[model samples]
Target: MSLRARAATTLVLVAAVLGLGLAIAVHHDPAAGADNATLRWFLDHRTPWATHLATALSTVFAPMWVAIAAVVVSVGLIRRDQILDRGMRVLGTVAIAGALAEVFKLAINRLRPPTIDQIGSPEAAASFPSGHVTGTAALLLAAALTVTASRAARTTAITTASLLSAAVAVSRLYLGAHWLTDVVASIAVAVAAVIAAPVVVDAVLAALRPHLPLRLRSMVDVGGRTSVEAAR
Candidate 1:
């Protein structure tokens, strides 16, 4: 599929999942039984080692770690040249995806699983969409798309990143922090963001190119040299 078509499909799937989840939440339906059962299974399977591993995954994808990663990636991009091109695309995807997840959380306003049923302390925020999963998926998928690396290396990076992101999503469920649908929808949002990032970045650069300083324009003109182009 075309990039735009893929992104649109992902977004439509996200909307469908979100709508179903919302309807279930609103009606207090028995469909939640599956969610509860899944949560219970995770809770029942919790071992110290598993808990430690999940905790580590959660910590690595925490807001603080994400910010640190952004700064590090930003600096690396600056050193490589084309911050407005590559850096902005990566950072913008993460920021926009995160904001979208937060907006959905607020809009859905679904309560998280009870603390008594959870492995850790209860989260205070609404939890229809998982922020951790959303951010991790966006960051990893963006990196997979934007990193300047060998094909084999890039494939390895994406594979590892995807597995890690999935692990983090499972961690959220294991911790009883979010429902299955929440994580699934967040993954869709991330995929959509990754697919759209280059398109958005290219459009923005095209619009700004004419007005930018000659030196800046020249640097950003290389923006077309992206993995998205390579795919074609």
Candidate 2:
């Protein structure tokens, strides 16, 4: 494997292991002392105005909304550039990350912080890997990779995504929607997804291209040219 592929694979494996270990740990004892302490600290420091701000931020990053925004943005960008491949990779990263987060939440079935401590309406979904943080991190990072080509631009994009994700993580914690470990695991998963998304999507499209009908195959651009162009 190339160095890029190796790094992505290593990060993904590390994330998976971290997620699984946290899941098992939380399953045995959902209320880990450190998590409780962090939640309580946020709760203790929250003000009415700050609570409202955090609620709005957290709501914006809610998994469902994030998915909707991703679709809209991807579609818009693809239409503007006529680059189906790039857009798909960007959208796929966010979608896959969000789906995995939901699956983990269901399987882990970890509870959110105590309802009484929450600043807004309680979330009905389980909260092991935070849906908000995962969605926000994935979308921002994926979009960064899609929109920028230079190494410097990529670095800036990653930094911006990380900062925005940190904001989302704080929002989730401030609202008492998730534990500390939940947000941490989500960041790891999002990073892994961002790193692997392009490679995975490219591989899938390449493998499936030969089997697709000519008209359909024309929709895919390989190496900066459409299949139809290559044939011509």
Q: What is candidate 2's TM-score against the reference?
A: 0.81
Reference-based lDDT, each prediction? 0.76, 0.76
Q: Summarize candidate 2's per-residue lDDT along 1-232 as a digit string, tens digits.
A: 6757757675775567365646555565444777889987886898888988898888788778889988987887656554456667779899778777777777777777788877767776787788889889999888876644568988998888889889999999898888888888788778777777777777787788688665444353557865334433
Write one digit per residue (lDDT tens) for candidate 1, span 77-170. Answer: 6446533566667787887778778878877888888877677777868877888998899888777766556888888889988998999999
Global lDDT for candidate 2?
0.76
Q: Model 2, residue 31: what's the lDDT? A: 42
Q: Estimate each model's TM-score.
A: 0.85, 0.81
Model 2's number of clashes is 0
